[model samples]
Target: MMEADILIENCSEIHTLKGPDRPRRGDEMQDTSKIKNGALAVKGESILAVGSDKEIKRDVEAEKIIDASGKTVIPGFVDPHTHLIYSGSREDELAMKIQGKTYMEILEEGGGILRTVRATRKASKQRLLEESKARMDRMLAHGTTTAEAKSGYGLDKKNEIKCLEVIDELDKSHDLDLIPTYLGAHSLPPEFERSEDYIDYCIEDVLPEIADKDLAEYCDVFCEKGVFDVEESRRLLKKAKQFGLKARVHADEIENIGCSKMAAELDAISAEHLVKTDEEDIIMMAESGTIGILLPGTPFMLMEEKYAPARQMIENGMAIALATDLNPNCWTESMQMVITLACLQMKMTPSEALTAATFNSARALDRPDIGSLEKGKKADFLVLDIPNIDHLPYRFGVNLVEKVYKRGEKV
Candidate 1:
């Protein structure tokens, strides 16, 4: 009964992925099925209908039609964890790491995240916004419709809010939906001599002001060995929840600090970077419905030995997601590059990698409204230049995205 504003016709294959259980049975958790010779009709900002070409054509009249004769149609990739607002690149640190300086050693020498924090604090908000906008343009070109950008590079409250405000302004101006997360608990600023005092200030001072202004939807903390411990992260996230923010944690990236278990117990939306997370934490996360977010690019870039237990998580029936971890520290804003790294290094199938990047990643953000192409869902999808979907990961290290559309309009 709904008339369509646009229709994409004669797609080589349309990947609807319109189901609750993903990693579709019998394929590796990364493989997805397709509907051959498909068509999708959209009205306003939602999918009006989808089916074989004949069926969709019969149901609605389209005001605009796009002939995607040789392309593959897929739901737009959703990236939920990223630190896109920073001042400069870490190429010098990358060079040092390649020269055999360890990540922790670099951090100790004040050359890692702290270095970026200093640079970001000095940069103007307009400059940060300019750099972040460029990165987001690249992400959109690579077929990402929705993404979460964190503000961890700004360790202090003023710079942190400035970074979040950049994200807020981007959402109003850009086509992509940018979700902002406040991460004052990311690290101890130079002014704070004691880590405990830093945690207290983040929880008591900054978080309340952020919540009052409705600046962020989520509050995150780094619950690693040198960062806020599991106990500190717990108290901080617990207090943030009282102020109406959902919880997220940077857990076990460098060591087993019990972040995954705490996130599971608290029913946090997700726990990211579980390279060193224990088997007990794995079981707990699976049982509690907390999504496990993996950052393959971080391990690949850092050449770390510990990889998130992807196969183990899939086998245990835990929902798993993949992210670029797009920060100044490790990863870049290339989601396709992350897909290739996830498939090759983490031993995930191409299909499973796609699912992890799309549907499951949306779940990690505690969102069900986006990520999949179903009737009545948001009309966000990518039209790939490739004919086959399997080529996404198989033919890696190349850009195959031909066109991207969101909200029933070509962006």
Candidate 2:
């Protein structure tokens, strides 16, 4: 046989969360196995073998050898929930939050998601694409290789299609594995301030066109107090599924209104922002196989008291994921900062946090092959300048990623 195309050798540590394994019910969290001083073999765009340096060395002859002598290696981070394509910033809203204004209060003042909706609807696709591309570049530098981007800033039909088209163009033009989600029900558009009219417009007018175009892999609804409620969100997502899109939800970020339970009942791919969900909802999500995407950054940026019950979810056997929730209104697109917040605020172990960012994040997008380092998986991974994997979250407020590889090629 021909030689392997590339070999990465002399790794100080290789943290591999190499399983899509679900633990038996009533057990501790799924455990990941690590290989110390590891080496991995790659051919073309796929991992061929991963083991100790000696083992991998004996197994393959390689045309190109990468000396990862001083670096820690881990699969690239996957951010599975973000609204990175939106226009405008909520800096004014941020200031209001500092003055003790709640998220609901700001939304009531037409200053939260709707503010972004107005700005995005006004901007051209070229502008949105350029801005979103720059944001993705920043995220890539932080070692995010696969990301799920939402089209929530455009709540109407034409603008929703505009946002998804931008996402599609970015995916075609960039190395990042961009998973697109249609979020036409993010909030009530200014034109249709009434909830029922907005819901009708989303389900009857907007979703049909989006579905006909086959532009998105999943459909999402924001099931919150001021946004689409549980019943309305369910109706929208139910209709979205008829168009052959998987379901996802923005649920219970600021209130415990059974959005999580609805997500479970609807069998959503993932439920995001469970800041106000309770133990029963967590169990429901776990039982329903819906990944919990916790966005602590949003709560932090909004200056809110509530955060997702990550520990409770973990203990309850739920697969927990952490994402930037990158958007104009909440978080900026910085996966490193999000990880730090996961550890400090979400109370995840360093290992668990890394797993959440990498493998579980891919799971959040319903993508199995891009998250872990393994044979037959995509050759996407990152090298850290930090001395150890623990430093990724331990050394807070630092840029530890040194290099990123997508499809076996450095970017």
Question: Per-prediction TM-score, please?
Answer: 0.95, 0.95
Against the unseen true structure, what C-alpha lDDT does each candidate score? 0.85, 0.84
- Could you give candidate 2's per-residue lDDT for residues 1-411 as a string of tens digits? 336888889998887777545421222334445788999888889998888999999888999999999788889999988987888787888788888887779979988767888899999999998888999898888889999998988877889999999999999999887989998887777787589888888788888888788899999988898668889989888888998999999998878899989999998988999998899998898899888888888888766666788888888888888899888766566788888888888788777888888888887887777778888889899989875767877887677888899999999
Q: Could you tell me which 10 consecutive residues in candidate 1 have the lowest summed lDDT?
A: 22-31
> Residue-wise lDDT of candidate 1 within 4-94, one digit each (tens)?
8999999998887777553232243544556889999998899888889888888878889999998999999999889888998888888
lDDT of 2 at 300: 84
Span of ten consecutive residues with least summed lDDT in model 2: 22-31
RMSD of 1: 2.0
The pairs that clash in candidate 2 are none
C-alpha root-mean-square deviation, each candidate: 2.0, 2.0
Best by lDDT: 1
TM-score of 2: 0.95
In lDDT terms, how accurate is model 1? 0.85
Q: Candidate 1: misplaced stretches above 4 Å?
A: 21-33
